[model samples]
Target chain A: MTSSTERSERAGAPAFALPFRVGRALAFHELRERTRDRWVIVISALFALLASAVGLYGRSAEGNAAAITGPSLVTLASLFVPLVALALGYDAIVGERERNTLGLLLSMPVGRTEVIVGKFVGRALALCLAVGLGLGAAMLAAAPGEARTLAALLGPTMALGLAFVSVGLLVSTLVSRQSTAASVVVAIWFLFVFFYDLGLLAILVATEGAIGDELVSSLVVGNPTGLYRVSLLASLGGENALTDLGLDVSLPSASARGAIWCAWIFGPLALSAAALSRRALR
Target chain B: MQRLTLEDVAVRFGRIEALRGTSLELRAGEVFLLAGPNGAGKSTLIRVLLGLVAPTRGTLRVDGAPVRADRAFRARLGYLPESVAFSESSTGREVVSFFAAARGAPKKRIDEVLERVGLADARSRLVRGYSRGMRQRLGLAVALVAPCELLVLDEPTGGLDQDALTLLWSVLDEHRAAGCVVLLASHEIALLESRVDRLGLLARGQLVALGDPTSLRERAALPVRVKVAPRADADRDALVQALERVGTIAPVRGARALELDVQPSRLLELLDLDAAHRACIADLQIVPPPFDEVYRRLLSEAA
Candidate 1:
C-alpha cells in the first residue's frame, strides 16, 4: 500500500514551484519546531491559567456579569504580551547564525529576504497560537459575564502582540549573540511595560504638565506597548473616552492608525532584512 | 567548457586580502581540488563562488552567468559547509527535509538522500544527539538532495572516521558519475590525490598551480641522492656522465653524494637500473620533498 502510494506520488509532479514552496515550507517547519519547546508550552499555559484566574476574580468583583471589559482585557495584555513577544523573537536570527546553519540556508535557492520575512512570520504565527490558547482560557474565565466583551478584545490585542514580535525580530538581527539578543529584547520589554509609563509620568511632573494632548499622542505612538494598549482599548469599546486623558491620548483615524501600526509591524521586518543581507557570515 | 570561472577575483577583510586576483576554471564532470594552508583564502574563494562574499575586485561566473542572491541563481548550487550545526531541536530527517523544502524538494528526494547518507534509521533522532561524523553525513545528505548542477563543498571531510570518509568519497564519485561538477576545498591531500581529476593550489589568495594529480606530482622535481665510494681508478667522469644520461645530475663533494632530479613515478626505474650499474654506491635515498614544500615554493614564485 505504501509502495503504491509512493508510485502515485511520484507520478504526480509537485504542484507548487520550488521557491514559494520553500518559503512556506521553511515557515511551517519553524512553526512546528519552535512549538515543541516545553518552556514555551509551559509558560503559555501558565499565562493562560493566570489570565483565567484574573478574569474570574474581576468577574466576581463586578456586580454585572460581563465576560471582560476594555480595562481588564487591556490590563491582562499589558501584563503578558511583551513577555511572550520578547521570548519568541529574541533568538530568531542570531540563534540560526550561532548554530552555523545560516550558511546552509543562505546557500540554497532561497533569498535572505525570504528567510528573514518567513521566520518572523512563522514565529509570529507560533506566538499567536500560544497567545490564542492563553486568551481562550482568559475568555473562559470571563465566561457568563462578559464573554462578548472578551471576544471583542482578542482581535486588536493579537495584532498588537504581533507588532511586538516584529520588534523582537529586528533586535535579533542587530545583535550577534543569542544571549545579547535576549538581553536587548528583555530591555525593550521593560521599557514598554514599566519604563515608558514611569518616564511619561516623570516628564509630566517636570514640565508641570506642559506636554499637551498632541505630544502625548505622539509619545504613545512611539511606545510600541502603549500604542498596543490604546489600540486594544479603542477596538474593544466604541467609547473613545481614553483619548481625552492628560497622557496625550488622541487616537488617529483608523486608516492613519492602521498605517502607523503596519509600519511598526513591517518597518522592523524590512530593516532587519537589510541588516541580515549585509551581515558578514563570520 | 568552463563550468566555473573566477577572473582576477580579489577579496579583502579590512586590510587583510583574503583572496588576491585569483582565477581558475573547472570543466563539467571534473573534480577540482583546492589545496592550501590555513588562511590562504581558500574559504574566501569558496565564499565568492557561493556569493557569500562579494569580491573586492574581479568577477565570478557559473555556467556562463553571473551569480547573485536571486532565487534563480541560488537554485544551481549544493554546498556542504564545514562543521554545519543543526537546530538543537530538529531531528536528522526534519533537518534534511527543511533544507530540501527550502529548495522546494520533492518528498521522495528527502527519504532517498537520508538513506543515501546512511541515516535512514536515525531519521527521527534529534540533531543534538548526532555525533560529529553523523552531522557531517547529514550535511552531505542536505547538499545532495538539491537539484544542483555544481556542488561547492568546503573541507567536506574534516572530521570523519575511515568508514565515513569512504562513504563521502563514494558520494563524490556518485555525483561525478552523474556528470556533476564538484569544487572541493580541503587540506587532506592523500585522500584527494587519488580522487580529484584536477588540483588547484591556493597560496596567500592566489592560484599558484593548477593541473592533474600526475602533473602536480611530476612538477615537484624531487631529487635522488646517491653516495658512491671512490674507486682508486674508477671513471669518475664516466660515472657522472652515466648518471647525467639517466637524468639531471649534480655532485656534492664532502659526502660524495650525486643528486639526480627525478619524479616519483621514475624513482623505481632509476633505483633498479642504478643498482645494475657498476658504480660503487654506499647509500641512496629518494627524498621527495613534502607537498607543503612544493606548495610554498610555487606561491613564492607566483608572488
Candidate 2:
C-alpha cells in the first residue's frame, strides 16, 4: 500500500508554487480585513482633506495652484506618507501575535517569509490606494494641468510609504509587545522626518563647512524621507532644490535614487522575514 | 503520514526544561489523548509536534524520513489551538475561506466546513459578535476546512457547549473513520477516556505512562468499586461475610446495597462469591477506577 505521505505528496501542489499561492491568500485576507475595518476609507479621507488644504494654501500663497500644489504636495507627502505607513504597519505582525493569530497563521502550510511578504504587500497596497484616492482627487481638482507632476509625486510618495512599512514590519517582527513596536515606530518617525535633518544641520553648522558637499549629499540620502523629498524635487525639474535651499548638495541620478528606494523597501522586509523564520512561535 | 515519530525530543526555555527526552510514535487511525495537570508540558509537547518549537535535542520523522514543518509537510496536518482567535473584522465564512485557501483546499470546502461546524446560519456574521462557543466552532471549521493525515487539537473543548461538543465528537469520529491520526491534549479525561485509543500521561516534562485505558487501569492497580444490591429477604450478613474475605466493605448505604473496594486482580474472587450467593444478590456492578483518578495517580507517581 502506498504510504499516506506518498499519497499526500502526490495530491499536494508543487513545492515552488506553494509560497506565492499562500502569500496571495494571506494578502487578500489582510486587505479584506483592513477594508472591512474602514481603515482604507478613514485614511483616504484624511489624506484627501490634508491634500486639499495644502492645495488651498498653495493657491493663496503662490497665485498659481498648478505650479505650487505639485511640489507642495510632495513636501506634504514626505511627512504624512511615512506617518500613515507607520500607523498602518506598526501592528501588522505584532498585533497578530498579541491577538493570538500569528501562531495560527504560521501553523498553516505557509512559510514565515511568505507571511511577512504577504502582510507587507497588503498594507502597502492599502496605503497606495489611500494615497492615490486622497491625493489624486485633490490634485486633479486643484491643479488640472499638473498631471505629470502629480504622477511624478505619487511614485515617490508610495515608495516612501513602502520603505516605512518595511521598517514598521521589521519593528513588529523584532519586538514581542505591540506597545513597544508602536513606541519604536513613533521614535523612528521622529528621527527620520523631524530630528534627522535637524541633527544633520547641527553637524553642518558645528563643522562650519568642514563637511564637504559629497558627505552632505550622502547624509541626506541616508534618510529615506530626505531621499524622497530630493527625488521628488528633482523629478519635478528642480535639481537644485535641496542644494540651493538647504545646503550645498548634489542629488544622485534618478535611477540611482530609484534603486535606493527599492533598497529601502526590501532591505528591512528581508530582515523581518529572516528574524521571523528563526523566531519561536509559542 | 503513516507513522510520525518524535525520537527523544527535548525542549528548554532558558533554564526551564519544558520537555525532556520525550519520545512517541503516532500511527494512522488512532486517537491518542494526552492528559496532565497544569505546567505538565502538555502544550509544550503539542507545540513541539506542530514544529512551532524546535526541540533542543530530537528529530521528527514521517514514515522514517526526517522532515521539517515545511509547507508541503504541514499541508498534511490541521491544528486547533487552545485559544482560537481570528480577525474580528472578518465574517465566519471569510475566515474559513482564508484558511482553506492557505491549505489549498477547494473553495467549495469553505461552505462545507462552515455547515459542518454549524456556522452556516451565521456565516456572514463578523466574528466580534460571536460568543466564545461560536468562536470555538469557527476555529473547528478552520481546522476542518481541508482534509489531512493528522489532526492536532489543544484544549479544543474549552468554551464549547453541549451541542458544539457533540459536533466536535462527530467531526473527530469522521476524521478517525477516515484513518487520520488524531492527537489531542485535554483535561477532560472522563469525556475523552472512552473515545481515546491510547492515553499518554505527561508529568514534569516526561512521558510517565502510555497505553490503552484498560492497560493503564491495570498498571495503576487501583481498587475497583463493586456494588451489590441484595433482595429484601436475602441474607445481608452472609453476603457481607463472604465479601469481607476478599475486599474491604464500606459502611454506607445500609441494608439496601453492599459496596466494597476490591483489587482488580481479585475481581474474579468477588464474582465467584456473587455466583455462590446468587439467591441473595439481585444486582452486581463492577466499576473500575475513574480515568481522572488514574491520571492523577500516575502523575503523582511520576512526581
Candidate 3:
C-alpha cells in the first residue's frame, strides 16, 4: 500500500507510531507464541490453582469475603509471578541474538528499541494473563467482596511481575547467552523473593528494631517483593496482618508504593531498551 | 548512478579490522556476489549493509543519503542472515507472519512467500522440527515478505539442496529482473558463475577485485592448464620440449605426464601442435582457469 497518497499519509502519521507498531507487533506475536508454550500452560494452571486455593480459603474462613488476613495470595504471587515472568522474558533479546535471529529482525524496518519494547510488552501481557486469571479465580473462590480490598496488594503483585519481566529483559540484553541470562534471572529471583527479605528481617532484629518507620518503608520499597508484602499488610487496615504476624514493619504511603512499583516496571525496561539500541548487534 | 555506495568503510572490532577500507558501489539489476573464505569479513560486510554493524570509519549511503542516521531507510532492504534460528515454539507460518507484520506487509504476503519458498506445505509445522535447509528457506520467506530495493543474503545456500538452490537462483533472477540490487555472500562457488552480474573477491577485509566474472578471469591473467601424458615416460621430455614452443611446461613430479601452462591466446596454436609431440599420446586434460581458481589465488596472495 505504498501508493502516493498512502505513503504521504504514513509520513504524516505521528513519528512515534512507528516504534510503537514494531513493539506492539512483536509483543502480540510473543504473546501468541507464549500462550501455546507448555511452560506457560503449566505456570498459568499452577497460578490459577494457587489463586483459587487462596480465594477458597478466604471464602470458607470467618474473615469478611473481600479478603482474609491481608490477601495471603500476595505470598503465593511473590513465588509464582516472578517465576513465570522470568520464564517468559529472561531470553527475549539475547536469545534472539544468540540464535542469529536478532540480525534478521534488525534488518527489517524495526529499530532495536522497538524490539525490546515489543519483547517487554509480550512478556508482560503473557504474565498478566497468567497471574490475573489465577488471582481472579482465587478471588472468585474467596468471593472477595468489592475488589477494593485486594487493590493495594494486587497492583503491587502485578507490578512485581512487570518488574521481574523488566529485569529479565535487562538481563537478556546485557548477557550474550540464553543459559547465562536464565541463571542470572533465577539467582536474582531467589535473592529478591527468598533471601532479600530474610536478610531484611535479620538486620531489623539484630539492630533491635531501632530502624525508623521511614527507613523500614524505604528499605521495603527498595525491593518489589518487600513492597508487595507491605502493600498487602497495609491494605488489611482492620486485620493488621503485619502486627498479628509480629512483623510490625511500617509501610510506605500509596503514592510512594505507586512510585516504587512504577520504578520497578519502567526503570529496568528503559535500561533494557537503551542497552539494546547501544549493543554492537553483530 | 549507484543504488548503494559504501565509501572507504572500515569496521574495527576492538583492535581487529573486520572490514578495511572497503569501498564499493552497487546498481539496480546487478547481482553482486561477495566470495571470500570464512572470516574474510564477508558476513561483516553484509551486516554493515543491513545496518546491523556500525562502520567504525567511513560512510555507507543508500540512494545518495547516509542511512546510518536514518534507520528508517532500512525499510527498503531485505536481509537473510547466514544462520537463522527462531523460537522453537513458533510454527513456520507464525514465524513468517511475525516478520511480515514487522515489515508492515499484508497478511496474504506470508502465504505467497511461503509458497514461493516451497515452505507453504510446512508452514503449520513448528520450526523446531525443521531441518537446517527448511529453516533457511523459512528465513528466505521472511526476507521476501516485502519488496526490497536491496537484498542482502549471507551464505544463503549453505544447507540448501539442489531444488532449493534452483529456487534461490530463480528468485534472484526475478529480483534482478525487477531491478533490485542483491548482495550475496557465500563460499559456495556454484552461485558465482553465470548468475552473478558482479563477483567481488574479498580478502583480509578488502575488495581485491570487483568486476564481472569474465572480467575477473581476464584480470587474474591465469594460464590454461594442459596436462599431457606421453605414450611412455621416456617420451615426456620430447613432449615437454615441443609444448614449450607454445608456453611454460612443468613436469608432474609423481605422474608420467607433464603440466603445461597454455596462454589463452596460444591455446589454438598448442592444439595445432604436432600430434607427434606425443605429450597427449595417451590422455589429456585441458583445465581452463575459472572463478574458483581465481578466487583461491587472490585469497592466498592476500595472505
iRMS values for every prediction: 7.2, 2.8, 4.5
Task: Rank the models by TM-score, top first.
Answer: 2, 3, 1
Q: Can you write out model 1's per-residue Cα lDDT over B64-108, one digit (the tens) per residue?
A: 765554555556678988778887788998998887767656778
lDDT tens digits, residue span B172-246, model 2: 888789888899999998889888899899888989999999899888889999998988898888888998988
- TM-score of model number 1: 0.84
Worst 10 residues of 3 chain A by lDDT: A7-16
Better of 2 and 3 by DockQ: 3
Error of 3 at B109 (Å): 1.4
Q: Which ten residues in a row have the lowest lDDT in candidate 2 chain B?
A: B270-279
lDDT of 1: 0.75
Candidate 3 deviant stretches above 4 angstroms: A1-19, A60-70, A143-154, A205-211, A237-239, B63-65, B227-241, B244-261, B275-285
Q: What are the chain B TM-scores of all models? A: 0.79, 0.94, 0.86
Q: In model 1, which runs have C-alpha deviations exceeding 4 angstroms?
A: A1-19, A62-70, A234-248, A280-282, B62-69, B223-293, B296-303
Report the lDDT tens digits of candidate 1 across residue range A39-102: 6677777778887786777677773323234466577677687678777777778887787777
If both were scored by lDDT, which would come out higher, candidate 1 or candidate 3? 3
In candidate 3, residue A59 scores what lDDT?
A: 67
RMSD of each: 6.0, 3.2, 3.7
